[model samples]
Target: MTDVSTSDETQVDVETASESESSSYDAAQRRSRQIEADLAGDAGRYRMLTGDRPTGRLHIGHYFGSLANRVRLQELGVDSWIVIADYQVITDRDGVGPIRERVLSLLVDYLAVGLDPARSTIFTHSAVPALNQLMLPFLSLVTDSELRRNPTVKSELAASQRPMSGLMLTYPVHQAADILFCKANVVPVGKDQLPHLEQTRVVARRFDETYGRGSLKAPVFPQPDALLSEAPNILGTDGTKMSKSRGNTIEIGMTADATAKIIKRAVTDSDRNITYDPQGRPEVANLLLLAALCTGRTPQSWADEIGDGGAGRLKAVVTEAVNSTFAPIRERRAELEADPGHLLRVLAEGNARANAVAEATLDEVREAMGMAYDLA
Candidate 1:
């Protein structure tokens, strides 16, 4: 009888887990569709918060996955805020090496990719003290166990195999601070990152409930909606997620010849019959996806064009597609790289603008919590 009870409990737990996952997926889809409709009619009404950690230069994966969307949003007139989360770089690393240079390189990449400073406000993490100040109140609202349970934190801890630092444990709250500091109503993210955004939403709601004046004072932060990328998962030459650490990434700043060399080395199956079978032939399909994104066409169509031409033909086509698509951007990058002062000036202006906004938000937060002692 005891054994039967244990088995029944296990089944119940599995069923609960499955139901929870399904519910989350459904909610995400609904939110995504709503965001799309909103963007079409009133893109200017939305404020977006999205960024990268300054660990390294971005690659094609970063471009399609998020950067392209950012440029599109800016062009559509959305108030965009791009943060170089420089402080987050230490979450898993033992030391900060050449971080300053990496941050500048990231700025150069942003300009090269058409992220104009006039349209999008670009800032870094360490420069905004008021933004980081939100962490204290936010940390008080959640339990330690909740932090440990966060999926991104859990994975990072496991991968690093190091003792979880306080900053790492409270990483989600820091992200919440990042979003709420600027009152961003929309954030671009992949499906896997929905959990992180959800935590941010939780923090926003809890802060309002704990400190807000109900009907008297409106909420300080919007529960930002997720703008899921429609971009395909781009695998690297090694048939894995493209990442710098794995030496499988093709940096955006690489020359045409360098890009061609990298694509030439990409893996493909021996079947030799070119087809877009993402499940069965992911490596070949990845190359096709890259070409499709570059040319604004379908991956299957690219596959059909290269039918029976084998891997050699597919590689050549992809190499040309990638190089031509980015050739103009590389030229701009080279021109910008020559004038480093302009890049620093861009950062300085952005930092000043971000500081003003963050300061105002922090004042509002203090007022909400009745901690505005300075007003006395």
Candidate 2:
């Protein structure tokens, strides 16, 4: 008998090499398909669903993340829906009073930021009862163990010492309900959210396989592909995630003086030559990035313009840029705030349109699942 034994080191190297090759191949295939889809303009066949959780007033991070994308999508003539995710807020925080106010403030922010209510439907999660109802049937399709394995749920659980509630545990399922109810074919998502999109696709596939007939639309749901943005991640003044809780956010509603003060107090390195070194001087780089975004100038240009004056000149230029960018938004927000009734009317009209679409989707869902007779 011939003995052919490999050492553990060699075996490990072989496995690692195989995995890397496989990952590269898969990524290449995904890229090819994405390019094909883009060239074909297949996005036209799809409706888009994207939103924020409305945990607090909108920040620059929110603007960069999905809000700006939403505005562009709306302009592109894609059927778009922006949900103020009021329900999801409960998963992370307590008390609805603050959230309710925050939710309305978010609407004002959205309007001020140029989300035309005419072009896009802006509504709340709680207003869509049919959409919420779909959660029940969708939940039955997946296992508890599967929910536990979701990376987002796991991360949230790890962040806190408190026990995870049922709402928090199955938050992804609720998200699926949100997308599937709209039958949205494209969901603009960040890289971190790919897992949730995958899970939504799974629920759609399961529903089609289990109950869909040939006469009914097979897999009526489209596995939404991500529309990645080119915007840089705007960091908080403290160099953390730009959040209201951190007190580092430049609120869209702030006056010019307030905005200037925040920029002046923004964190930066002690020995700053105003270079854009995110790794070595994240705080300084972040400020520069904000200034660039506001002024419509490249960060490199800003760096050149403010060279060698240290943090003081950086602060001055940044404050000027930020004040200039937000001046219009502040004026518009104040105008909208003056007439609270107009905001309510916008929500009411949006709710009606959203309800009509959601109810139509729910009817089809019920018919597919043989529940139409029960409803009749």
The local distance difference test score of each candidate is 0.91, 0.80
On a 0 to 1 TM-score scale, where does candidate 2 land against the true structure? 0.89
TM-score of 1: 0.96
Error of model 2, residue 319, in angstroms: 0.8
lDDT per residue as tens, model 1, 1-376: 9999999999999999889978997898898889888887799999999999998889989988888889999988899999999999987777767999999989999999999999899999999999999999999989888888789898987887668888889999999999999999998888788888989999999988988756327887788998877877899988998999998988889999999999999999898889999999999999999999999999999999999999999999999999998898899999999999999999998899899999999998888987888844
Residue pairs clashing, model 1: none
User: TM-score for each prediction?
Assistant: 0.96, 0.89
Give Cα distance to truth, residue 178, candidate 1, Å.
0.5
* Native-to-model Cα distance after best TM-score fit, residue 363 in candidate 2, in Å: 1.3
Q: Which candidate gets the maximum TM-score versus the true structure?
A: 1
Scored against the true structure, residue 270 in model 1 reaches a CA lDDT of 97
Any idea how many clashes model 1 has? 0
lDDT of 2 by residue, 122-186 (tens): 89999989989888889999999889879889988899788998999989999998888878877
